[model samples]
Target chain A: MTVVATDETGRATPVVSGYGPSFAEQQPPRNERRSPRRLPRGLRIALGAILPLLLLAAWQVATAFVPAYRLPSPASVVLAGVDLAQRGLLGVHVGISVQRVLLGFAIGAAVGLVLGALIGLSRWADVLLSPTISAFRAVPSLAWVPLIVLYIGLQENGKVAIIAIGALFPVFTTVAGALRHVDRHLVEAGRAFGLRGVSLLAQVQLPAVVPAVVSGLRLALAQSWLFLVAAELLGSSMGLGFLLTDSQYNGRLDRLFLTIILLAVFGKATDAVLGVGERALLKRWT
Target chain B: MTSTTALPVSFRGVGRAFGTARVLRDVDLDVAAGEIVAILGPSGCGKSTLLRSVSGLDAPSEGAVSIAGTAVGPVDQRCAVAFQEPRLLPWRSVEANVALGLPHGTAKEPGRRRVAELLELTGLADAARRRPREISGGMAQRASLARALAREPGVLVLDEPFGALDALTRLRMQDLLLDVHAAVPTTVILVTHDVDEALVLADHVVLLGTDGDLPGATVRRVVRVPGARPRDRGAPELVDLRAELLAGLGVPAHHTAPSTAQLSHQETA
Candidate 1:
């Protein structure tokens, strides 16, 4: 009887195609071969672009029915961006937003990692800190703004504090949860080999949670962007969020559309960069 | 590499209890320097707990375990263990994972050289750069063994290291283990359920079992197998010993011939 093997894609191929004892002699030596069903990279990317292009077309069509003051055409939005670029105001706004996001995300994520590790590794720390942290997390991001502005007085530091608060919880939650679930067998093995405390965490526990850590970082970054807008809208002299409010008050619908588009592009661009790093980390780890 | 000075390990009235449940009771055994001892027992007999005590991974509640006349500490530096599963770090390559077993504070150059030597000895030279997930089960186990040896440990603890491999691979691994022991000459404590494996590799086979109505298992028998390294598996003496061991384990003897009286009576009928 011939034996059959089914690959992950639900395709069955006979492992030994013929039913005789000499089937092994008849078969060629097995070697690495790529699956025929996979689409090419270029084709996959093109497939992904199709939906966005369709949405753009739909938006362009909708502009003809709506008044320009209410809903600017895509071409007019592009013109508004060109106008801002020529005046150099667009660069200043975009740069400031990017800077704020990076700074706040860095500080928040670093603190979150340390605190999360402490809470996850030590039962005493968990018992002491978890309740207070949960109460803080329950307060909304916007709720921090009034208190932050009162203390820091609408400066860059106040805006940064808001963004940092936004970025903190995701990293803290994921890192702590992930650490608790690292394979017990692996930890025991490491301990058996003379690993203890910090060395054990570095060699085994931390590396085992790379995938979760990366995902946490990604979530933290997205939150940074969200809180950046909140902080900027409240009290920024220059930023994409400021541009958003300024355009709305000035009734420049075209520039308002431009700001929204820029936000989308920048957010996706940052996430993509993180995605590349995540892939590299997961390759080395899991 | 210079030959490691194997340290003697001793257990005095060792017993273990988890909460109210006892697992081992009054277990006493002494391992000579550079000797191989196999602990064979049924499931739940605390064979693993006994080995873990030697490595200082688990402490016996009632008694002490000592290495070289010094009581074992919370995390004994004198011992290294290869568990039933490979338990290799998936993130690390085989070479790096093996390097992790090197004793703390080893110099960089020496550590690298030691890792290389173990990779070669374990027949993992080509797969040194490969991650744990890339290698086969037997290869992973060899890497685990190599990792344990990289410590140059006084006592190497193996808890069913070859139990997960196929029969052919298991035989090959047993031989590889012999080779490793010949090179390092460290004290080894092996826990296994396979009777044949115990007879093949150990100088002394220790059987652990519960006595009468005892709550916990203890040392039931210790048989010193005759002959030196690489003894004949099918020798008459070994075969007879195998039968006796099987009988002691409550296994009935197989393939015995009918008596002459029964055969003659059947023919007359």
Candidate 2:
């Protein structure tokens, strides 16, 4: 029986030809698209470039039919970007937006993790804080602009605060839920051996919830970017949001398209970085 | 170390209840130092609850449980438990999981050596560097046993440790368990539902059954297996004993002729 099974999978080249390729040949080849692991570095890069190239081609074709003033060509957007780069305003705006995102994300995630632990670990904290947070979360990110600007007098603090507020809820909810629902058997096993309170939490509970928390952090990061525009809308002198508004006020379709594209690239880049870090950290456990 | 000193365990009038339901009632048993005892019963008979109380993971609501004359508290360092699931940390390698069984402040060199010794004893030395996810089910279970024995605790409590394995693996694990017992000689409290397993591994077999009057399951009887280490599975004495245990479990065991291990299935059918 074992010999027949082996022959069917391994050496029976023609007997099961109607069933498609033998199991050995069915194994993915080095450069097959589905088996990207063994693909050469240049081919992998070309594969990644295909979708953006197609999208750019479609946009360029669309621009020819649309009114030039209403929708600028991709080449016009590139020219506008070059024009901004000559004046150095593009670098300053991009740097400022990145700075705001970093500041807001760090503060929001730290507080979210602490608050999540507080509510998750204690019934009293959950009862005292969760209702107010839920209520606050119901208000839109745009709605917070006036209140934050009024409180902080329309400075970087107000902008950063709105982003932080936007980032908090997802991180808080994910971490709290994950920590609350950790595997009880793992805890029992930890304690059954010599693990005590803090040690048990450090060795078992914290590691178990880390994957969930990292995912929450990723969601919070995307939220921070979404609120970046609304955050800077509350009176700002510099940033991608300010540049976007300035380009719209002057009716520079090319500049507006360029700024939007820049935001997309920035958001995608940051998310990819976070994903890499998460994969590295979770590699040992999952 | 304290683990080298085998500890006697005693339960006196122990009873436990959860909210309105009582799960164990007036349960009492005494296990001598270094003896192997198996608790056998049908489902919902509170066999697991009794083992949990012994490990101090759960408290008996009515009476006290003592280990070597000391009352069990919230955590009993003298006992190490290997639950049914391997329960190894996916993050840690097999050797590291076993090292967790060592006392927290154990010196680095001694702890490493002890973990290595346990890995060797459990036949997991080759797989020590592998994480829990990378090993087979039987290998993972063996690693769990290695962890439980890492601290050299006086009492080793296992809650159906081999219940999750395939038949061949389970038999191999059972034999490996006996080999481990011969080498270490710690008092073992094995909770199981398989009659043949209890007979093969234990010095004494306990049956827990619930009565209408009692709030929880109580010990029905204790049968002492009359043989030495590495006992014969096909012995006539064990055949009768298996029949007797089957009868106690309410399975009709009228087979007086030479019986095989399939007696339970035949009787139930």
C-alpha DockQ of every model = 0.20, 0.20
Q: Where does candidate 1 stray beyond 4 Å? A: A1-37, B234-236, B247-269
**The best candidate in terms of TM-score:** 2
Q: How far off is residue A55 in model 1, in Å?
A: 1.4
Residues forming the 10-long window of minimal summed lDDT in candidate 2 chain A: A1-10
lDDT of 2 by residue, A169-210 (tens): 889999899988989999899999878778988999899999
- Report how far off residue B263 is in candidate 1 (Å): 29
lDDT, residue A174, candidate 1: 94
lDDT of 1 at B263: 11
lDDT of 2 at A199: 93
C-alpha RMSD of each candidate structure in angstroms:
8.3, 7.3
Specify the CAPRI tier of model 1: incorrect
Per-residue lDDT of model 1, residues A1-286, tens digit only = 1111112101111111122233223222222233667789999999999999998898899988988888888999999999999999999999999999999999899888988898888999999999998898898867988998999877888888888888888999999999988999999998988778988999889998889989999999999999999888886789999998999889998998899899999999999999999988877775
